[model samples]
Target: MESSKHKHYHVHDFDSRQFLENYFSDKSDMVFGDDTLKFVIDNLKQIFSEGHINGDILIDLSIGSFIHHLYSACEFFKNIIVLKVNNRCIMELKRWVDERTGAFYWGHTSTLLQEKEVNSDHFEDKEGHLRSAIQHVVKYDLDKENMTDPLVLPPADCVISDCLLDAISKDQDDYIRYLRKFSRLLKPGGHLIIIGCLDTTYFTVGKDKFHVFTFDEDFVRKALVGEGFIIDYCNVKKRTAVSDLIDYKAIMIIAAHKEK
Candidate 1:
């Protein structure tokens, strides 16, 4: 594929609202509702409830203004720091965090998560808890040696990223390089949970097409191992929804720990 044919996320201006409406909305036509959203929430709930992932601070480096995955995380981590590469995404997230008008409604996503909980609380309580847990929403530059730059962040107890590697990476080397950066944010033996689509080259948000680096399950395992992470759990689900917006062979969720 020619690099000129597709728009890179690093250089492009992504419409956070359009992206959310396209995939994260509760509409029946939203393809990623079950494949990506539900799958990630389920895995995260199980991972956090399992008692192995211990952490005071969790750094989230997910793509877009997504917070559904973090709903389960807030229960385990005292502080959640979200890192975004796009300013629009940061503002979008802040809208939700600050309870400002025009924020994307996440009631549906919260309801999905509540169903998985043994003794789930009210939806308002869940939303409130998640908002409180989010301590910071900061911008990061992957090209910089220090991704967070002048704001030198403390070593996190856990780092969770969703679909970020696929969106930013131009190739396998780029994926591995970002993985190393993610690992560097963690303390030795800290957990790292990742959720991403496999064999996807591009995904459309509204009229704009964005690049998505295609890779297989074997490559992910090898990459994580090479980055000094011990894989504890991995689950791959075949794509069931047929959609023109995105073409992904499968979706994968991985839970690993940095080697001590």
Candidate 2:
């Protein structure tokens, strides 16, 4: 259970399964998967189709409990690593990946991917590909000095982080600091793909609230440039005001590469 007063500051007690049910459910997914998510998936498809995005290791930093964000990464990488913030999310993700009896159904992601001209058509085929591509699903902590310690993982050729920073960081300063930490996981010349909600203060699930650091496109681009990244692509999609999930101005998607 999360304290209603401090839910904004607590990360470990975040509900993984409830998040999946509220946001990533096949029913709820239709709202996002069709519109706002379209921009993100479209940009990914463009680079992949243009032969600009492909590599051995593609890392996704936590991405909360939802797995649909990595659906595009599966086609471009030989190995994909899904990093999580806690074991609860790990267990929830594993349940879906392992095809457990009561796992949250992921059919909607596959359905959306199929409509995008992705290489795979069959839902099982896409799931198999994602399952095969994912080599690791380890825990990550933005508060840590070294996000990963004791066990060293391979530096990624590409990293895809979706709104995890806003979820974990308590403020703009922490967000920038953790962004630098996440950048260290990439190899020189490696690509970083980010999808975030702009100007969000908080999002709720059930009765509990979680913090989302407020940021605009200029701040994100400026921060990444300061970290010595070359911006390849950046775009924002305005929310259609359909769901009451959160109050955010828009969805921002950015693709940048570290200097070699």
Candidate 3:
């Protein structure tokens, strides 16, 4: 594990500091509120509509800071494999798992399924069973950049890319390369769900360029298609998790494999 709990990387100006300062200052809960959850849930519903989920989804918990996306995913599908390659992310994920309820919360980090509780209702059973709907939550750690290596992933039906790609690459070419690696993580015809932002201008947040790639929907669609992903659904949001800060907005891309 790295010396730091989280991997040290480039930081960009995203007004996160100001928001946090104001947040701790007791200015407003709106600093980083539920809009992201709404966006994530809405996008997820659209993805679900495009295909049927059969409890065999694999979510790239690539950045396990918040389980908002994971929780929403579990609600729709039963079995989910959450993979986090970063040690810090794994530690963070551990904090997100609730010790008591075994339910999903903002920053839980305990085991959702307890081994000692056999037939103890630890797993989420089928509907009307009074048990949790989500059964197993498999966890793995692999560095994001090493995802292409065989050791990082296992076969999956679907993959979720939430706030991950932007933190992985510096240019469009590298981003495409990264996406291709992500593609390989899934079985043929598996789905990839991505959510992140794009701004025309570069801004700084935590000493890094927050908007390294000012991606437009057209550019991203072209890139995904070029990289062998068949576009299933795409939604361009005028505002994202950082809508209050700048003129640029975010885009959500949900795609699947092209018929070969």
Question: Best candidate, TM-score-wise?
Answer: 1
RMSD of 3: 8.6
Runs of candidate 2 exceeding 4 Å displacement: 1-6, 28-31, 118-124
Report the Cα lDDT for candidate 1: 0.89
RMSD of 2: 2.8
Residue range 42-111, candidate 2, lDDT tens digits: 7666665666778999988855567777777787899988888778788988887888898888776667
Per-residue lDDT over 59-162 for candidate 3, one digit per residue giving the tens place of the 0 to 100 score: 55443345545543554555565665444444444543434343223221112222222553643331222123323344442244554444554566777776
What candidate 3 gets wrong by more than 4 Å, as runs, is: 1-27, 32-34, 49-55, 75-78, 98-152, 200-211, 240-248
TM-score of each: 0.97, 0.90, 0.65
Off by over 4 Å in 1: 1-4, 122-124
Looking at candidate 3, the ten consecutive residues that score lowest on lDDT are: 107-116
Candidates 1 and 2, the one with greater TM-score: 1
Superposed Cα deviation of residue 182, candidate 1 (Å) = 1.2
lDDT, candidates in the order shown: 0.89, 0.76, 0.50
In model 1, how large is the Cα lDDT of residue 77?
88
